[model samples]
Target: MIDCAFKLQEQAFTLRVDHRLGAARTAILGPSGAGKTTFLMALAGIKRPTAGQIHVGDQVWSDSDKRIYLPTHQRDIAIVFQDSRLFPHLTAFENMHFARGAKVTTLQIRQVIEALELDAFGHLMPRQLSGGQLKRVALARALVAGRRYLFLDEPYQGLNRELKGQIMDFVDLWCRDQVEQVLITTHLMGECSHISDEFMVINGLGPTFLGPLHELVQQESSLKQLMQIGIENSLACQVIANECDFIVAQLSATQLYVAGHAKVGEQVVLKFRAEDVVIAKEACSMTSAQNRLVAKITQIHQIDGRVLIHLDAGQPIYAEITPRALSQLRLERGDDVHCLIKSMVLRVA
Candidate 1:
């Protein structure tokens, strides 16, 4: 079991938090400047806190009241950075074993090398390694160190998807085989969600958000905002080549291109902002509203002096309504209505 409570004040930012961690893989997730790195740094004992208590099962690394502080080496924690940080002068083989005092020995090194698929590159120099190779080496180094807890501060940030998967698999397997804890941070929640036993959200510089990934994904409004949407229109979209910034999907039915995340053959619902929709209280024949969806009024709530109208668009959709409009139209639940949507509001998300 691990329980950490600490406070750190710097010239640029002030971070304070308390959390209890059990013996399982956990992730520390936050946007940029949310102190994810700072929290990990403190966990690794790289940065001592002004006040705190750090405790493991039978040991206490820090207790401000007693004026007790343990150096990083005594904390039994290993951290992997975004950069591999391997010595360029050394070969991959030498880099793994040079500092023989690592937490794991030769047998462990062999296992790590196999798990991370670094056996082929072990003989090569750091400079000869590709981005993925460097990342694998760095991971091996951390696993070879053999700590009770592992801290990864965006360790896979710069790598491509395939490469990131390779290293992430190794780490996952290692934790499964050992008695350990993991706290990693990543901006890509979709990919990271698979590797995390529990997911947490850290927003701003105060009040860290913690919960199970599934629950957070379902109930947390913040998580919805973080999601990368994939929209598959209910029409024929000819497959075009994918570009870096956006996917070029030919909507023959609509004659438009929108950015999205989709494979060769997939069916998805298109996404749009609520404000992009035009609301009408009265009935009218279908005019030239490019994408008009029929919905039933479910509920209405006032948000910031504006009405947030809930519509059951076969599915569920939200539309912003003003109080004056709601009063003027006498909108209520069970009212059938047509929503007018502009093509420009349609986005691949």
Candidate 2:
């Protein structure tokens, strides 16, 4: 059980939360100053709330009525912050052992390292590792610190796509494996949607929206209808052909494309994750997805791990699929596949 409520008064803002989140993955999502991080800090026992009740499992960290408070360390919670503060002098192994204590055997250390994919880097000092690597080590150390309830304060900040994906995937898998409960704060609703079982969206709040992530997404359909996804090149496409979860569209004079949906000449929006918009390998039928197009993979972006592939779809819609999906689709600068998108996946954009 995770219960939290707060009455906040700050120079710039005041937040009051009266909410309950079960033993599931709950995320705090909002803009910069929406008190997401503050809430995480409160839950981690790092910051005290003005008035509220904070509970996890059988313990109560804060209570307005009872005036009960649990100090940070005594609360026994693991925290992964936006900035992973690994000791400069300490190696990953040293850090883990320090956090884990003497009771943790070498086997446990090995398991943590393996689970976080830090086996090779475990011996390296914090300075020698990448940003993603540092966060992984930090999280692993926290996990070893004997805290079952985890509070992550923007764990994905300042990492490359590949590294971010790796950390997030590892975290997701680790959460499932340990049945760990997480209360995370993030600006990236996309990642939150993929990972968290529930979402707590709040800012300088009187009321925070707390509910299932999917349900919230459904409720936002109308709002999203007028809103566009990623600023990457966007365009409206005419669904020329439709199939099971797939649609074929003629994007250009020479380029023909297939994607997730089409309503036979109906104008619809399509998103091609610059990464997944790979060049085709000569129109093939070798994918679970049916939308493949023959067009020029115009450009590439090397952002803070994954490369972005830009393809010329007559009109581009951003399909934010996984990097792995991009690779498996075998998209390149000039190659094409029957863009394998199912029809039902189409949503009004």
Candidate 3:
């Protein structure tokens, strides 16, 4: 568990955070200049807090009253900053090796390089690598360090959508198998939804919401922010079958056909935009949509002239529809409905 109650005075506002985060994987969300980075830096011991204390489990990292402070290196942490801080003189491979000081086995290092697709550019110097390549190197360095806590700040900033998804898969697998805790800060909520077990939203001054994504989306302020950026419905699934064109995933009691490749028995996250979901009063077999599940309306929110419908079809799902459509369906809380989604629209995250 990470128990922290600290205050840091930023130039614009005083950032105050008081929370006990026990989630294995937590995603930090907030607007620009909201001090999300500041909070992460403080947790990493990069920036000292002006007051209060930070305790991870039974270990006290920082306590102003006790006059105890642990340096960055002393903490069991590895961080990937927004910018890659690779050694200028060393090659990418050397940078990663230097971070771990050769403590990790050669096979372990090789596996990380291959998993991140960094083997090809490992010999290149930091000056010779591209922005995306540099980011990959920084992430590789952090993973090789084998620390207890992993902090990633916009780690996939410069990567493309496809590459970002691939890297996220690798990171997710690595975290599940190796790390104890992972905290990441990202503007794109859906991008990390698959890996994050809980979310922390830092607003103007400090953290305003900290909970599961399903609960966070229910808040008026958080829902508005999510709607502005376009909300995504992320479902936890397990691959049951890998067909030639798509993969069959089991979502609780329902089966979802996704347009992606995944080995059978592998756990994956199915992501689709809320706008892509269509709600129906009853299941329709005449439609071309391949995936349909019976759901019950849990909550309805009308924001920015659009209606956001929350549903429970064994798992939480969101659908965005126009106010006119909402009126046409007359969707009310507790009404049973069917969610229709085309297979092609579903992607593995």
Ranking 1 against 3 by TM-score, winner: 3
Q: What's the ranking of the predictions by TM-score, best on top?
A: 3, 1, 2
Q: Which number leads on TM-score?
A: 3
Instruction: Compute the lDDT of residue 110 as modeled in candidate 2.
Output: 71
In candidate 2, what are the lDDT values of residues 92-159, reduced to their tens digit? Answer: 97987778744456776677777678888888989999887888888888767756677878876766
Segments of candidate 3 deviating more than 4 angstroms: 101-103, 205-207, 228-230, 252-254, 282-288, 303-306
TM-score of each: 0.62, 0.62, 0.91
The alpha-carbon lDDT assigned to residue 168 of candidate 3 equals: 88
C-alpha lDDT of residue 141 in model 3? 97
Instruction: Supply the TM-score for candidate 2.
Output: 0.62
**lDDT of all predictions, in order shown?**
0.65, 0.62, 0.86
Two-way lDDT contest, 1 vs 2, winner: 1
lDDT of 3 by residue, 102-169 (tens): 45677878888887899788999999999999999999999999888999998888887787888888
